[model samples]
Target: MIFESSHCPEDSRVETQFCQNLVAQANVDRAITPERSTSISPDSIRPKPSQAIQQIILFTPSRASNPQIQAALVKLQNQVAAELRSRGFTVQSVPTGLDSASAIAWINRRATPNTFALSLQTDAFLNPDARGTAAFFRAGDPQRQQQAEELVKRILRNVPTLVDRGARPDTETAFGRLPFVRQLSVPAIVLSVGFSTSPQDRNILLTRSSAIAQGIANGLAPRPVQARSTTQVPIRIRLNGELSENQGFILGGNAYLPIALLNGLAINFQRPKTAQLFT
Candidate 1:
């Protein structure tokens, strides 16, 4: 989420803090579930596990001594951190670390399995005409590429004014190149939510900061489904290439053999070595 202040540092602190608080509030309102609370409906497919742990790295052009900017960043990351934690993800928010160190820290964290890094940034290009959102993802990886594209669709779904600048290759900037992109093994993306130079773009970022943050959390959260009562029914045994017509019964969630009817099926049956004791 990008936050800008047209009124110097004064508005920056208020707007930035507001944005963070909004994300936290929205997430709570959404009632995000921390567990993989999957309910198997009659028509539902097999349940999938929760989304993997993710890292959100929100940045600004780091100022060595800008207290307002730094404070806002801390608040922003904190709110987003709480939002993500409620959604069944082990999330870490890296606020104010904008250079090589931030990217390096991502490397150390993503070394563990099932981890990804996402960044939010604000831009004020010399060209005030610059507008819209831009994102960077792993250049050649298809799965990572799709994740990047999905982000754009989700983030800008409600904000119609913000143009979809498209996902780009992280190839040349502090984030686009080797230390950050090329050699970084984990999936990573840098999202320029909006350019501050353009009045229109700047307003979108400042006004919709929490909404944008919520949009991001929603995108990253596991797709939840309605739960259905699980009543154990007859168990079907598939042998060779076909399923059993009515091969077994389920009781106490376990399939049991009706030994008297076993000979009716063509399935081969044999006693195990342990069964010799009973014989």
Candidate 2:
């Protein structure tokens, strides 16, 4: 965010030139930044349950060398992808014995407006003593960034025993951005499920793999609307924080919305030419 209070010229004279110079300097600084990434807005294609989410890519990125590491990573990847598929998600994984880059490349080439990617990794780079989960998302694209954070929160709920490291900014200046997340063409989240070197963290991965995968699935899944019961509470409705006449007082709490809003319901009136109507 630009701070106009500090930077704006006190005198209005030659303000345009001052503003132009500031913009030029900002552009130059941006050019020198190595972490810069191209961004796209997905306004037309935010994933919806029936139409938006067509394919999900489950990827474990490293090209492991050790025999044990390679076999174990592949098994984890397969099982997680399997769990997502079982939840009725269309999931694709790197076929047995193939390099991760190939699978990632395939995903990039075939990425549709309606797909999302899940990049799974064991966070061994973090200190061995540090334990818990973290999720990462590229900067920009608020909807995509939010999806990443919400999924992280959902993962936390399922894996309650583990410490919550929370979500990390992929574009933070201290840690240069993650390349895979930066380049991936779809909305993506990088999940560090646990630390491999930490024994307890390792145990969580070994024991709760399915539950974690299921949590991720639930985060992305279209929530089922509860059948409206006799119980109801009236509330003034707001859409995206703004209230409109189209939005009237409805039966629900702001903490959670009713199914009528989720799937959409309309109150309609039919009038005859001569009729004077009362609501």
Highest TM-score: which candidate? 2
TM-scores across all candidates? 0.54, 0.58
Residues 146-246 of candidate 1: C-alpha lDDT, one tens digit per residue: 76677777778756678887776543232113234334445566666766557787666556666676666665664577565345466667767887675
Q: How much is the lDDT of residue 38 in candidate 1? A: 24
Candidate 2: where are CA atoms >4 Å away? 1-51, 63-73, 96-101, 173-175, 228-279
lDDT of 2 by residue, 37-134 (tens): 34332322333332377688877755343344445555667876776677677887745544545765677787777778877766542235756777
TM match of model 2 to true structure: 0.58
- Candidate with the greatest lDDT versus the true structure: 2
In model 1, the runs with Cα more than 4 Å from the true position are: 1-51, 54-76, 95-98, 106-110, 172-178, 227-279
Q: After aligning candidate 1 to the native by TM-score, how far in Å is the CA of 186 from where it should be?
A: 2.1
TM-score of 1: 0.54
